[model samples]
Target: MSLSHEIMKNICGYSRAKYSTWFYYRPDHILFDAGEGVSLALRNMIYGIDHIFISHNHGDHIGGLPGLIKSRASSMGDITKPLSIYYPEKDSQILQFKEYLDVSIPKLPFVLTWKGLRPGDQISLNANRFVEAFASDHMGTLSLGYKIIEKRKRLKSEYKGLPQQELIACIKDLGREAIHEEYHKNLLVYSGDTMPLDVSIVQNAEVLLHDATFVLGSDREENTHATVEEACELAIKAQVACLALFHFSSRYSHQQVKDKIYEIITANNVEIPIHYIYPHFYPSDFKQIQIEN
Candidate 1:
């Protein structure tokens, strides 16, 4: 299987525009959003999440916080584990929701933290992995996109093409750091709910889960969401290894959604495998619909 396929196997999610959207990246124990039915969909797996990154304060994006928190506290799992939630700084709606949760669930068993983040802020996952926040255009309120980055080491340009023995000797004599340079690779980029992102933001990412709220360009009357064509174009321009479109509007049928995406991929000759989450009932299996061109 391709690396993208392997990565997708570990992720489970559900998205329906103006309704709900959530993704559980099992590898990192992170949830992107806590839309309605998230707790029910994940069931016992909800306790596995250690962190949640909220993109915006939209109801569809954050309606499940109460259930998720209560489930972690009272469900059939470890209730003492702490969970951290990160959101765009100064989001009033989210702050209000947090207050409500505090008032409603005063005696929580587990530690729950809510931290606001600005663009360029990062939360360390490990010594070499982190989640960084970036500004995104969605609503009047500040919204954010997230990128999961991993630090990797590569041989210095000057050491490239050197014989294996020579490289080994250089590493031995000058130390590994001296012979290599550190680079950041984007493991995943989540464009929560917004227009087509700038190519630079998602450049070379292994997987990009972008907003595809409209299948027909003419149907989009506002600039808040992206069309199917725009998402595909962004993926190609960014050279992302994999594209997974989500948050589709319910107006389009499953076949309509697939046809539009296929049209775009074929027109552009997009080589990366494209996947989509249709806007229907929130699926329990959460398998992404894959499209190849």
Candidate 2:
């Protein structure tokens, strides 16, 4: 199924313990990373992407930039759409890659812009939605995580006790500003290749796509990727609506990964729905593979 039609569906291009990792949030036209084979896997759907956010300069995270750029320029899709790429500030590898693409594809059919992002940087998607970057623990490689926030207005606590007629009269006489408060809601959080960190960063999120590169804690490396158990704990602690785990280690079979996740959820009594992307497989629909709570 095409992910573009579903507002909550996500597209993933990842092969754990391999050379590629990426997630495409179709509703926002935002791509979390540009890992290898991303352009090929997405095909024409790539034309819809207007913003590409790179978590870090790791080869597995950014190896597909050149191909994606070239395809957008030369393919049968619209060539006039502007593409903006955001990466960590002062990332040597990304800087080098930018220079390389400049020299290799000197003349492109569309405009390509690059921005350096720092921790806590926010990029506005529209008037109501925006994306914020946060520092992630990934072997000290200057990695970052992203959160999608939406601005919303809610009725003030005092207004909740008022009758409907009173509320309508208040709105008519005092205006909405007097009875409502604007707040930001966390829609989705993507933990790009990071070890488990504070759960508060992703509290109350609608969905969380986290790194689960290892199934066993014994297999986890110091300050690197998170294991399945860690991802589950964070999701449960944060009370997220759903957790989608990706970046599984290639050493484990699909059955092994599923078994471990079930074991963890059962042991901890986690109530949130948990989903996983099988290693080496490209899932067309994200919701189909969710494991029962």
Say which candidate scores most in lDDT: 1
lDDT of each model, Cα atoms only?
Answer: 0.89, 0.84
Positional deviation of 44 in candidate 1, in angstroms?
0.7
Indicate the worst ten consecutive residues by lDDT in candidate 1.
284-293
Instruction: Give the residue spans of candidate 2 off by over 4 A.
Output: 1-8, 283-293
lDDT of 1: 0.89
- Candidate 1 to truth, TM: 0.96
TM-score of each: 0.96, 0.93
Candidate 1 structure quality by residue, lDDT tens digits, 1-293 = 87777777887889988889999999899999889999998999988899999999989989999999988989899999999999999888899999999999889998899999999999999899999999888965699999999999998899999999998899899988898899999999999999999998999999999998999999988889988889999989889999988988898998898788777777777778888877674563433445542
Off by over 4 Å in 1: 281-293
Error of 1 at 162 (Å): 0.9
